[model samples]
Target chain A: MSAAGGSNPEYVIARVRARRSALFGDEEYRKLVRMGPAEIARFMEESEYEAEINALGSRYSGVDLIEYGLNHNMAKQFNDILDWADGRLYDLIARYLRKFDAWNVKTIIRGIYSETPRDEIETDLIRAGEFDDRLISRLLDAAEIEEVVELLSGTIFADGLEAAYDDYEDVGVLVPLENAVDRAFYEQLLDGLVVGEETKQYREFLEAEIDFRNARNALRIARSGADLDPTDYFIEGGTLFRAAELAALATNPDELVSKIRDSRYGDRLSNALSDLEEADSLIGFERALDAALLEYADTLGYVFPLSVTPIISYILAKEREVDNIRAIARGREAGLPPEEIEEELVIQ
Target chain B: MIEAIEPLMTALQSEAASGPAISPSAAAALAVGLAAFGAGYAERGIGSAAMGAIAEDEDLFVNGLILTVLPETLVILALVVVFLV
Candidate 1:
């Protein structure tokens, strides 16, 4: 649909709300955590993951079956939303779904670099983004990273990837290329958005995500004491930190935490800041950030029920569900205790 | 319709009177037409939303239908205005 047409928020919100109601609640997660891999797969079979489990049941078993089923279901659910959206709603949503495009491109590139088989790479792909099967197949068939860059020529990632390729060639590291793809995605998110009152909240939510991401990256770099410049990791458009400010802040852990505590997210993340100060653990802080973002999105949905916010809220919730289930299956496979595994989940 | 237009045409020809342009019954008709338009506009969003809900779950069809037509009350109230006039 053309951008000139009005958004069908009421319809989109209604459909998204129905799907949102189907997501696993806290009780389901509790039960799933206690179960073994086989039991968990069976549990999923009886729930929303039924069709996925039955469809993949013939070929795979155990955690691999559950993993593939979860990924496939996630891709299907997200693609269904994208298909249902129209006009401006489609534009707003496709902006976020393009994260999967970045994921697919990165997966294909890493697979090629590691000499992984095509089918192995294909299984990891989410396929929930804008890329059609033809383009993705072409990407998978490309032997060289340069070819992947070339194949993405007309796309948003093309310019960023092409420029980053020079750095990749120079340093023989995929970091620059990956950063380029991420930067391109984040930059395009807020670019040229025509902000109405409803979309201003959507824009703020996007900015909060960027801020959280930058805060996490800065904390990680600070904790590592890496010699690398933090500005290289600094994403644009967040209210939290400027690139130069982040570069300076990355050198000091206490100052960086305090900086985040002083920002607009200070109130929401106050507990997380104290936790970071006391435990010095980034994982818990990151999870807190995730919960805060989820809660923030939920508030936005409540504040503007028929706009783009609820759809985004569902998207985040669905992605968290998929991630939580994957964590459960993998944690169970690795023989971790249920409590520790539960600690890793970011349910809200 | 032709008979209704006859008085409006005569009024247009006699331009000296600076008063209400249309008769009270004509005004009431315009009000009901606008009220129906408002009802339709209100139902447009609700009907689409209800259809979307029903598409996801067939059991919601009855509920959707009920909500979709809830705005028809506007026209019904405006019909009361027609009678009172």
Candidate 2:
């Protein structure tokens, strides 16, 4: 159980595999999309989400109950992984789970800046990250945005927030602070990672995610024809596009599409790229990216069944399930037709 | 001092020549020991995975037990080398 001991990928992978199979398939999604919010809640209770649904059932009903249950279950599941992992596995996972830390921080900052109630903000905070209950409570208790930033002084966000705080004072917008937090998370993601063969593959997977994100941002900027510089949105460490290249490509959607099609991800993303060209919609392109990333992770898992890949694969699949369920619930609540809701899903 | 050391050296040499450092039976025992170690190493992963599966679902108990013991065949194969030796 000590950090010095070897990783227990075997045990984690077994549990992960079991959970992966429990995720909703196409049939479940079809049924869920056709069902009303109450029916969806009922359906969830009969499945893997039974406990969360039942626990939240009394307080809230319909979509709110479903959403809260999903968030709570997601946090619990991810936290359990961190609890079960030890040694380097824990370190690797904690690094990734820090995304939720960033999520919580941004939510609190926004809540304070907008004068949202503390209890209302609390419901939005996902407890999946390395941040313990004490830290989260402190953040929630902070009355001002500055106090929230000061509370994060010892964290990875400290330096980034310190720099961004100046920009916030000058511009009076939350964008700079949010970007700084994101940059901090992405920067720490691959920092000083000692690359073994499998870890190198993992690194590549992460880089691909960064690349796709950058590409999506570029595409959106190009589509919008905004006067804002694309370089501001450029995330470092992606191998696909340099900052200067992105600035140029962001003005030309065709060139951006061609560039992505010519890269190493071209084969896997060919269909998505073509869809982007034909459909000319950001949502479809984003869904395609999600599906492609999910497929890539699944392949990586099978290729190296005994490494962190399987766990990562499971994590991605679980996140997708949660997203799909959320989308279905929200879409149904909005009275969107089932066919349109199906389009919103990124199911494989 | 030289006279005392000379007799002790000869006695030690005579004792060394009386038997081999490691007998064949001892080597065979070493082989079984190493084989058992290999089996245990293999079982470590399978056993953990089986336990995880069993913990998830009660129906998997039998399956988990079977997979957990699959690595025992390595020790069994190593035992044949014991008989041959």
Best by TM-score: 1
Best by the DockQ measure: 2
Residue-pair clashes per prediction, in order, are 0, 0
In model 1, what lDDT does residue A278 have?
Answer: 98
Chain A accuracy as TM-score for every candidate: 0.96, 0.95
Model 1 Cα shift for residue B32 (angstroms):
1.5
As a TM-score, model 2 comes out at 0.91
Give the alpha carbon lDDT tens digit for every residue of A245-288 in model 2.
Answer: 99999999999999999999899889888888898878878877
- Mark the regions of model 2 whose C-alpha exceeds 4 Å error after superposition: A1-3, B1-20, B76-85
Q: What is candidate 1's CAPRI-style docking category based on DockQ?
A: medium
lDDT of 2: 0.86
Q: Estimate, for each residue in A21-79, the C-alpha lDDT of model 1 and write its tens digit.
A: 99999999999899999999999999889999999999899999999999999999989
